[model samples]
Target: MLNHIIGRLSLGGLLARAVSAAALLGAFGGAASAVTVPILVADVDSGRVIYSQAPTDPWFPASITKLMTTYVALDLVRQGRASMDTLITISPNAAAEPPSKMGFKPGTQLTLGNALKIIMVKSANDVAFAIGESLGGSIDNFAAMMNDSARRIGMRDSRWTNANGLPDPQQWTSARDMAILARALIRDFPDDHDLFSISAIQFGGAVIPNHNGLLGRYPGTDGMKTGFICSGGFNVVATATRGGRRIVAIVMGQPSARERDVKTADLFDYGFAQDGGNGPGLDALPGSSSAAPPDMRPYVCGGKKVPAIDEGPGAVSASATTAAQLVGGAAASSPSLALAAFSSPGMRARTLPPRAPLQPVAVWIGRSPAEGQQILAQQAAEAQAAAANVRAARLEAAKARREAVLAKRQAVQAAAKEAAAQKQAAKAAAKASGGVPRSASAYTSSESASMPEAKPGKGLTKAKDAAKPAAHKPVAAKPVAKPVAAKPAPKPAKKAAAKSDE
Candidate 1:
């Protein structure tokens, strides 16, 4: 090894070898610190990037992938393939999705309009999956539609594997691509713009608030979505309108929801302050170095308990005061945000004020309000019938158990009675005899009538003889055996002749 190293050192100068070693180390060191936070803010009208940081780098889309799902559903509506009144039935496949889900049972039905509302505000994974299955006939088909639409709209770096933005290795998107999708959503479906801006939605008695922290807290922050996973961190594709100007901001790979929201607010502040476009339009951004996105599990979820769903409305952290000072005390002047700042001096955590009462838009199942009521009534009746059937089955099983017990008791009693009758007969027969009666085994007969009635004296004699002990015969046994051996065998002819005579 030393000789080989020496030869290489002689071929390439010692300085060159040292430089190569240093370069390799530096590359490894850079990778160790490569935890990037991709951010982008673009004008909605002019399609220009206002502020950006590694905007073209691929990153996990997380729940924000629902934005693409919403787009596809709305596009189908535009093409006259579906309508808002379209029914989406929850199948076993959809109902089985993980949390940030509605927990709807299989066979539950709801309108496309209600499903969209639930997915937008609550980011219900199950509902999103159902929409995919209902609208596209299956999850795979819907994903195909999503990819096709994305390509058509110039989202060059985005790839979708599922309707809901659940974690998947193959699924990824860049800030630039997400911005393009947001632009397309705003431009293509202007009439349905209110869908993205919903604050909260009322499904039944529970009111589910949107996961996007900026909606109600950040002034003029109207629509868009937020997403999170251990591998992706917190992501938001947020759009805010201030002073009659609207811009879309994409923030990705933040450690927490607070940082995501604060950085987004800061970007909006920066984007609105800019008078002209920054470098280039969103489409003109350069390609990424790698196609695969970086996994953020270590930075985002390291040594911490990560939440399964998007973050909900939370109290401002204690560091809000510290962050307020960093942003130049903009929090005191406006409830909207702090100020334009992006340095990671303190992670840029901000404290948002309490949100106002949410007027959640009402959402329900079925085609119409009246029809929904009828469906509810029908479900209630079916529940009652199922309960009744269960009760009846239990009662029948109990009755069978009782009947079985009674039959078992009757069988035991009949067996006992038969034994008693046999004992009584035996006792009566013994009582009739003065002495020990002859043993039943001594004279066995199939029919009593075949044997002649014994004379009274003879019967008593036989009984007495049977009860007496036998006297020991010394030489009688040998004599009787010899006599039997000497006897001649009977001929067949003689036996037949005797039988004929009889």
Candidate 2:
């Protein structure tokens, strides 16, 4: 089971882990992630912490959020507002949640008990959303209830913005807070406690297994929950009973889900070994309730944290409780299947979790099963009709898109044909006028060629001839008779004789 779960995490879900790691380190200097992951182990019988590390640091809760989500639903049942058989209808908003979902269509209806099993077994985000909507009228209203529950249970450092624990930087919890939540579930809702131990739920023709690997991989591990996100690596709050001694162990900010399990198992072993003093009460631990929630996104998802971040004393992280801006950055988004590969390849478990008896929680919508089914059938019909209308609308839209495309193509072809016709008309018109439409360059060249060539003598007259039309042909000159030269010579001799006689 661990192998199956971790295989999903390592495949592609951990991309954000590295990127978020880098940003967190840079923002908080170098030592932030080293101190933020909170771990707490407590003796359930005594409500005393056996061991703790960074118990008050705030971190993302991931799907461990379902614990509170389950608590709230069970609380409603105990309050007479709802029941184990309560039918939760999937709304559009709930259906829209990302994967790790049950993919139940809008208007789909099921008993609250069955929903709990599926979510606990499969960690379905959509079902969690639906559960919240069904309970407190809306997720927001349910969240208000969750906060109230957290306060009542002394989960001092936790805040919930969603039911499924998807990425919202604002959603945070601490290891101690989770332990508190786990203890509350154990103490308040003992009958419904088995929901967390379900190994798998059969949905349709397939089986969706629980995300918690410890259930079947560790000894004496009876029940609890596991969660992961990029910023908050692998987180698990596990509990096991051995020889009548029960210990609840929490491990957070693990690099992998497998590591989270191993650490948790070890903590439980350590917890059971203690016969000594039970530590302070969970809420009585030394820490400010107002401590800001630390963001581990950069370290976990940012792809930057190394195998080892140096451990050191707290730096400037200490700030006034009122002024602390603990918006833990880069909190885990939707983890892919690759986060915590179940086991390092070929690893065999020496001790697997003890099998828990199947105990289904029964919740109700204040109606008989048959009456509920009738109402559900009616709702299903309406939903189906609505879906048909939507499909028709979509088909109409597609037809419109295709028609628009075809019309655009036809317009382009028509424009091309009209341009060709206009060109032909222009050619016919030019030919009828007996005038060739020459371009400026062509006309200039023709005029230049028609101009007469100058005689090449040095004069302003020759310069003026340079501007003549290029097309002009020079006329051939006729040869002058030789008598012009003989007459000039004769006149010159007569003039010379007259000058001599004078």
The most accurate candidate by TM-score is 1
Predicted structure 2: clash tally: 61
Point out where model 2 deviates above 4 Å: 1-34, 288-290, 303-502
Candidate 2's displacement at residue 364, Å, is 14
The Cα local distance difference test for each model comes to 0.74, 0.64
What lDDT does candidate 2 reach at residue 437?
Answer: 41
Expressed as tens digits, the lDDT of each residue in 331-439 for candidate 2 is 1221111111122231213223443433333322224556655765776799899999999999999999999999999999999999999999999988897564434
Candidate 1 regions exceeding 4 Å error are: 1-33, 311-349, 377-502
Total clashes for model 1:
0
TM-scores, all candidates, are 0.67, 0.59
Best by lDDT: 1
